[model samples]
Structures are given as C-alpha cells and as structure tokens.
Target: MTAGRAAMLLALSWNMKMEEEIKKILDNKPNLRYVVTEVGGKASEEFRGKIIKASMNAAINKNIIGKNAYESHALLHALSEAKAGVTINSSMSVSFAMKVAIVRSDHWIAVAMFGQSAFHPMTNHERGGFGIMHI
Candidate 1:
C-alpha cells in the first residue's frame, strides 16, 4: 500500500482504539447490523483510504455488511434489519450517518454521530427519520 494509505489505515485503527466508548455503544445495540464510514472525497486521499479501511475493520468486528461496491439494495436490506449504522461522508458530514442509520434500522438501533459540523447542511425534513443520536 502507498505510504498515504498506510497512514490512513493506522489513523483509522488509532481512532477505533481511542473510541472505545463508541464501540461499547455499538456492542450494546444487539440489533445493530452494520457500521458504515464514508470515504469523503475532499478529506485528503489518505484520510479517505483510512475511512475505507476503518470501515472494513469495523464491519469485521461488528459482524455487519460493508458495501464497497454495487450493493445499495442489499445494503438497504441489511440496514432494514440492522440495529445501527455509521457513515463518514463529508458531503453531509457525520450527522448524515444518523440520518442513514435511522432510515434503515428496523429495531431502533442507536445512532452514533462522528465527523465535522459541516455535515449539518442536511436538514431533517428532506429525508425524515433522524430520531437516532445527533453526535
């Protein structure tokens, strides 16, 4: 892997280790089926790489489905049965993760928000079902 990619992977691992609280939250939610982290396009190529790798790692640990390709429909199916979701898109920021999680969860899995405030651009009315955690 490129140095940048390696750095991202390391960073992601570090974040995972550091965020034990978050992991605990996920573990508590038995219904949660998947955890997603968006690979933001603008957040440096290295960060994006980290996001993807981190997401894969989270998937393995959480035993959830990780979508790296054409599986939107399948993802949605999994989301419907899931307890929670984690997304890392800068477009809507981490808050969007809450939106995505809430919309997809069938068992009311708690949502954990991460990322920047810039994600706030996403309004509640546009998508609906953001009852999950805000941050």
Candidate 2:
C-alpha cells in the first residue's frame, strides 16, 4: 500500500484503540461525557462551519460552554507535520502529537482528515463524510 494509505490505516487503528480506552474511562465516571467528532475532506469553510456547529450543539445539549468544546485543528496540523517528517523534539511522534492535541483540547468536537494521498494540497481524493461523531 502507499505510505499515505498505510498512515491512514495506522491512524484508524490508533483511533480505535483510543476509543476503547476512552470508553473505559468514561464508564468509570458516568458524570463526564466524551465527544469524538470527525470531518474528512478538504478543509473548507463550509466543512469547518459544520464541525463547529456540530460541536456547539453537542456542547449545548450537554450543558457545556464554547470554551469547553474542542476543535481538531491541532490534531490535523500534527498529522500533517508528522507526514512531512517535521519533528519538534525527540518524542514528537504522530501518536504523541495526537495525544497532546487531545489533552489540550479537553473536549474534542472535530477531527478533520483531509486527503487520501499525502501530496501537497492533496487533491484527487473524493470528499468523504462531514462532522461525524463517536460519542
């Protein structure tokens, strides 16, 4: 498989594992809620707005404020950076970046994935899904 496909598969696996872990944690604390949102396609204004709206609605339904909601821009940036082989430090793996982004966000509302190929301004891949959630 191509490197990009391989990376995407690995990311999917990692995300699945994370979902399991998050589930366990949440199970222990029913008072807390975890919202995992995904937006896959070229990052457009409309797509971003959709994610923002989804996140806002989720937060409001859960009685949360704007500050408590999280966006996945940092995660997307880290994935891009990792794919580009840009490392900030020795421990700056893609997984590390993802964890950091999630922690910083606290309540991630969006996790946008752009492009199937890792090419610059990745094009050709058909847009798939918008503001998907795994809550």
lDDT of 2 by residue, 1-135 (tens): 222332233234345676566546544654343334343322334434444455445444544333432333433443344323322222211121121111112332222232232224333322222122222
RMSD each, Å:
12.6, 12.0
Q: Give the CA lDDT, 0 to 100, for residue 80 in model 2.
A: 40
lDDT of each: 0.33, 0.33
- Estimate candidate 1's alpha-carbon lDDT, on a 0 to 1 scale: 0.33
lDDT of 1 by residue, 95-118 (tens): 322212211233222222233323
TM-score list, all predictions = 0.30, 0.35
Residue 20 CA displacement from its true place in model 2, Å: 2.9
The regions of model 2 sitting more than 4 angstroms off are 1-13, 62-135
